[model samples]
Target: MARSLVDLLTTHAAHQPERTAYRYLATGDCDGEVQELSYARLATRSRAVAAWLQERGLAGSRAMLLYPPGPEFISGYLGCLSAGVVAVPGVPPQGRSQNHRALTRMKRLIADSDAKVILGGHEVIAALGRLAEHLPELDGITCVATEDIPDEMAAAWREPDLTADSVAFLQYTSGSTSAPRGVVVTHGNLLDNQRVITERMGHTPDVIAGCGGELFVSWLPVYHDMGLIGPVLNTLYLGVTATLFSPLHFLQRPDRWLTAISRYRPHTSGGPNFAYELALKHAKPALLDSLDLSSWKVAFNGAEPVRAATLRRFTETFAPAGFRGEALYPCYGLAEATLMVTGGTVGVPPVLLEPETGAADAAAVGCGRPGEGVTVVIADPEGPRELPEGEIGEIWVRSASVAKGYWRNTLATRESFRATLPGHEGRFLRTGDLGFLRDGELFVTGRLKDLMVVDGRNHYPQDLELSAETCHPALRPGCTAAFSVDRGIEGERPVLIAELAPEAVGESEKITDLIRAAIGDAHGLSVHDVVLVHPGTIPKTSSGKIQRGASRAAYLDGTLAPVGATAVR
Candidate 1:
C-alpha cells in the first residue's frame, strides 16, 4: 500500500521519469515563455529541499512556505511533505512596502503555526530580509531558498515515515487571522478528497486519453485550497500534467485564461463567479473568433456564491466558440472539508430553483449533490434536528474527506467539526453555509455568519447586494457588501457598502438613495446606511468573496470614505 503522496511521487518518477508533470506559463498566455518540470526533476529537487530541512533538524515541525507564483512553490511544498514537516503555504510579500497586507498575513500565520523554518524564493527571501528589523519573530527562523538547494543534497535525503493519520498540512482560511483556526488536514483527508474530486468530476483515464492526457490550466493562487488541492495536488495524485500561471496575468487580461484553454484543450478548468463575469467583460468579437473550447469538458465554478446569471451569461457568450452550457459545473465546498464536498454531475446542465415569492432572477442555483461516500443534510442551525427537503438550513456534511479538526483549537474543532444530529450517532461537519437539498441536489443560499436580521426576519447578504447591484446601472455588480450593525437602543439595522463606477463617482449620493429605496421597496427593509465608495474599496477575501465582517469593521472604524458625501449616521 502507498504510505503517502511521496510514495506516489516516487512511483511516478521511477516509471515515467521523462513525462512532463507541470508547465508554468510566464506570460499567462500559452505562447509565452514556458517552464517545464518532469517527474524525475520534480522528485529530485523536492528530495534535495527535504534533505536541507532534515539537516537542520526540522522534521515533524511546521515550515512556512512563502514563494511567488511559479513551480518552485510546488516543489517546496512537496519537499515539506517528503521531509515529514508540516507545510504552511502563505502569500509572499511583493513591492518595497515592508508592511504589505500579504506580509501581514504571513507574519500572523508564522506566529500562529510557530513555524521553525521558512522555505521561499530568492526575491521573497530578500524582501523578508529587508523587513527583518520590523518583524523580529522571523529573525530566529531558519530561511532557505528551495530553488538554491544543490542537487548533491538529494543523496542525503531520507523518506520520512508517513501514515494515513499523520498531519499533512495546516490549511488556514482567509479570515483565520482574527480567530486563528487552522484546519488540521491529514494525509488521509488529502487522498480521500482527491478521490472525491475524480469521482465527482468524472476525471478518469478515459477522459485523460480522449483529451490527449492530463492537462489542466489554472491561475488560482496555490496558497488557497482550490488551487492547491484542486489542480496542483490532483496532478500529482493522477500523475498528470498541469499548466499554471500567475493570477495577476488573468486579472490583467481575462481573455488569456480562455486562450490558454483553447490552446491546451484542457479537460478541466475553473475559477470563481467573478472570473466568468470578467471574461464576459473582455470577450471581444476578435478574441471570441480565435477560441475553440470544445475540448473543455469540465468547467467548474466554486470558491464563492455561484450565480445563475453568471452561468447563463458565460454559456450564451461563449457558445459560438464551442463552449457547451453543460460544461458549466457548479460545486460547493470549504477549506474545513478539505476542498470539494458537492459537485454537479458532469456533462449535464445545472438545475435552477426559482424563488418562492421574490423576482425570477433572484432564484437560487443548485450546487449539485454530495460526492460518493459523502452525506449531506440540511439542519436547523438553532438545534440538531434535520430539516425536510427544500427548507433552507445549515449545510451539514459527513464523509471521510472531512478534516481532523482545527489545529490546537480543541473548542473550535469540536464546535464546528464534531456536530451531531439528533437521533444520529455519527458526527457531521457544520459547513456554516445556509443551503437546502431538493430531489437530492444541494442549493447553497448564503453564509450563516453574514445573515442580517431585522424586525425578526432573516435576510441573506447576497440577496441584498444583488438588489443593490441591479437597482442602478452605476453600481458595480458583485462589488457590493450588505451587512447588519448593532444600534444598541435602536436595534440591529442593515448597512450597504457599494462600489460605484468611475462615471458615477460624482453621483454617489443619487446612487446611494437609489439603492436604499430599491432595497426598501423590494425587501421591505429600510437601509440604515448607504456608503457608495470608489470601485475596489470594499474588502474581499483571497478567493474574491466579499468579506462582510471586514467591511463591517471598516464601517465601524470610520475607514470608508464615500465618494460624493454622506453622514456617518
Candidate 2:
C-alpha cells in the first residue's frame, strides 16, 4: 500500500476518469483546437506508449525529449515515466550565437545519458539534424518518430504496481555554459508535492477554474517545472480546465496569453517576473484596453526573485483591464522541490513589503506557509541552529516531496540532503537560497553564494538592481541588475545595468549618474561601473531571471555593451 508517483497519477485517472485531464495546444474556437485527453485516456495512452517501447526493445531505455509545446511532448514524457525510462528534457534552441553551445552540450548529455533513442517531433528532429552539422556526435543519436503516435498501442503494464522510490524523470538546470545539470526526482517525491499543491491550491471541494474563472492559464515552456507541473499538474488533480499556451508562441507574439485569458475567462495564471514585465513593455495598448482580466485571481510569481516594482507597475497598468491590485501573488519554488515551495493563501491579497533595496534589513515577499507534510526552517549554515524569525539565514526544507538528489553524483546528493532540521524526521534539502520566516510564512532573499560583500556590508545584486530602477522617470522600475566586478582586482564595487526607455537613448550619461549617486547615497554601495542597455538586452531565463552570470560574462568579454555605453562605465 505504499504511495508512488505513478499511483498518484493513476488515482487522478480513476477520479473523474472521463473528465478532461489535459489539453494540448488549445485554440480560441467554441470547441477550441484542443487535443483533449481525459484522465482515463491519458492513463491508457501512457501505458500503451510504454508497451510500444517494450515491444521495440526500448523499455528502461534512456531517451532525450526535444519538442515544442503540444500533446506529443506530454505523451512522450508520461510514456517515459510509465516505462521507467530515463527521460532527459532538452532546452529549447536559443539564438544562433547560443545554438552551437546548446547543441554541443545536448550531445554531451545524450552521450553521458547513453540514450538509445532520441524521441522528437518532425520539426524537432529536423532541428536536431541541423544541430548535428555543428556537433558531429549528434548524428549517432537515433532520431525517431514521437508522433504518428500509435493511435492504439497496447498497455505496458496490465496492472499498475509502482514503487515510491523509482526514478521518475530528470530535471535539468542551466549551468554557466549551455550545459545543464540533471536533478533526479523519484515517484514519492513527485506524488508528495503533487498532493501538497492540490491542497495549497485550495481544492477542498476540488478547486476548479472554468473557462473564465479560476482556470489554469499559462504560457511558460513545458521544459520548466512551473509549466509542466504548476498549472498543468495542479489543474488536472483538481479537475480545473487547464488552458495551455507556449512561451515561444507568446514571445513571438506577446498578446496571445492575455488574449486567451480575456477570451477564456480564466482567473488563475502564473509566470516568472519577466512575463509581467514583458506584458508591460510588449503588450499593445489597444489589447490592454480590451483585456477582461477581472477574473484573474492568483498570479503566482516564482522561478526567479520577485522584483517589487515589476509587480506594482503590472498591477497599475492592468488596473484599467479590471485586474485588481490584490490579484498579484508573489510566491517561491524550484524543480528540486517539484514545483511550488511556498505560495500565497488562495483568495487573499499578497504581502508586498518595501522594494528589496529599501529595506536595510533585507526582507522578501513572503511565500506563505509550508504545504502538506512539508517542513521549512531557516538555519545558521555554520552549523544547524535556528535563527530568530526576522533574521536572514539559509532556507532548508524537509518534505515527503523533496527529491532523492542528483542522479549519478553521490557527493552532490550527500551535500544536498542531510538530517539537519530538528523538527523534521528525515534529511533536508539545502535550497542554496537565503531567506527567513516572519509570523508563519517563508520569504526568499537570494542565493547564498551570490551575495556580494561591498565595503564590509553585505549586499545582494537584486538589491542593487531595485535601487537603480526605483522611481526613475526614464528607466522602468525593477528592470536593473547589480553584480560585483571581478575585474581581476580586489575590492571591486558592483556595476549597475539599467534598462533605459527606447527614446531616452541619448540620456545615458544622466541616467547612469543618477543611478550611481542614488546607490552611493542611499545604501552607501558605490557603483564601480554603469552600463545602459536597451530594455531586455540583459538575458533572462524562461522564468524571467536576470542572467547575472551570463551578463557578467558578457561584460567581461565585452559582447553586451553598446557604443556609447562605455562612456559612463
What is the lDDT of every predicted structure here? 0.88, 0.71
Q: Write the per-residue lDDT of candidate 2 for residues 91-150, one digit (tens) a residue.
A: 645567657656666776776666777777787787777656665666656786666556
What digit string (tens of lDDT, one per residue) describes model 1 on residues 1-569?
A: 67688999999999989998989999897888999999999999999999999988988899999998999999999999999999998888865543467777888889889999999999888878878899988978988788789988999999898989898999998666456678889888999999999899898988878877656989999999999999899999888899899998998999999998998889999998888988998989999999999988899998888887778888999999999999999999899999999999999998887776756566788888889899999999998799998899999999988999988888888899999998776899998999989999999989998888898998999989988887887877689999998988878999999988898777777788888898997789988899888888998876778899999999999999888758466
- For each candidate in turn, the TM-score is 0.97, 0.89
RMSD list, candidates in order: 1.6, 3.4
Give the top-scoring candidate (lDDT). 1
RMSD, candidate 2, Å: 3.4
Error of 2 at 533 (Å): 2.9
Q: What is the number of backbone collisions in each predicted candidate, taken in the order shown?
A: 0, 4
TM-score of 2: 0.89
| Clashing residue pairs, backbone N/CA/C < 3 A, model 1 | none
